[model samples]
Target: MADITTTELRQRLQAGETPHLIDVREPWENEEASIPTAQNIPLGSLPEKLDDLDAWKDEEVIVHCKSGSRSSQAKAYLTQQGFSNVRNLLGGFTEYSAG
Candidate 1:
């Protein structure tokens, strides 16, 4: 899996680059705030919800969580599940907020 910094990802989104953005954080954390185009899919539920992300299998799926850890795991898992393109949002949402 590739890794993209928050700033780079933000710029891409702002510039009309629409990647398959998935937020692997919990619902409550997401309710607080999230990147505009991000879809919610909590980490714990990802295995069961894999089909929901099937459309993105061939496309690059950007994953994020509160920090970078969970998102990294998510990226790895998704890749192992046959997702060809996965990128971890380095530093995740927390870094996004910091910037």
Candidate 2:
């Protein structure tokens, strides 16, 4: 999986790209803060939620959590499941929020 830094992701969004963002954080964490465009699917529930992301299978999908760890796992799983353009958000939401 590729690592997408917060600044790069922000620039891409600013450029009008609608990349698919998957939040692997827990629902409560997401409720506290999240990117408005991201789809919430807690890490534990990702396997079951795979079908929901099928539409984005061929597109660039950026996975993130509170930190980067969970997002890495999510990226691996998605790639194993044949997702062609899965990326892990570097430093995850923490960095994004900080920026």
Candidate 3:
């Protein structure tokens, strides 16, 4: 497991890097706010949706949630499930939106 700061993530997104961005927050939270291009995969459903993310197995996957905590858990879970590359967006959407 690894981590990327909000600054780095923003730069990557701006550069058109296509990382598999996973929003692990709940649907309502996502509806209120979200980073552009993020795919909602609420933390609770990630286990059942592994097949949907298979195409991103070889690519870098960046997970994020409301305040970064959930995203950390999501990243660990994905890594344990054999994901080769996973990163938690440090400070998550709250910080991203603020900055």
Candidate 4:
């Protein structure tokens, strides 16, 4: 797994690149604020939702949570599951929101 800073991700999105973005935050947290294009799958449910991500297995997936911690775990999990190109959004949504 690799690390992608919030600025980099934001810049990519602004450039109209639709990289796969997965939000590992819970429902309520997502309701507060989230990347509009990110798919929400809360960290706890990720294991059960593996099939839902199968299509992205070979794609560049960017995982994020409120802070970087949860997303790091998510990135590791996805990498173990054979996701070849997974990245943790460094500083996660907190940094994105702040910027």
lDDT score at residue 75, model 1, on the 0-100 scale: 93
Candidate 2, residues 1-99, lDDT tens digits: the string is 468999999998889888899999999999999986999999999999988889888889999998899999999999999899999999999999999
Q: Which of candidates 2 and 3 reaches a greater lDDT?
A: 2
For residue 30, give model 3's deviation from the true position in Å.
0.5
- Return the top candidate by lDDT: 4
Deviating ranges (above 4 Å) for candidate 1: none
Clashing pairs in 1: none
* Model 3 stretches astray by more than 4 angstroms: none
Least well predicted 10-residue stretch by lDDT in candidate 2: 1-10
Give the local distance difference test score of model 1.
Answer: 0.91
Model 3 Cα lDDT, one tens digit per residue, 8-93: 98888899987789999999999998899999999999999999898888779999998889999999999888888999999999
Alpha-carbon RMSD, candidate 1:
0.9
Q: What TM-score goes with each of the models?
A: 0.95, 0.94, 0.94, 0.96
RMSD score of candidate 2 (Å): 1.0
Model 1 lDDT per residue over 15-38, tens place: 999888999999999999998889
Candidate 4 lDDT by residue in tens digits, 1-98 = 55899899989999999999999999999999889699999999999999989999999999999998998999989999999999999888999999
List ranges where model 4 is wrong by over 4 Å: none
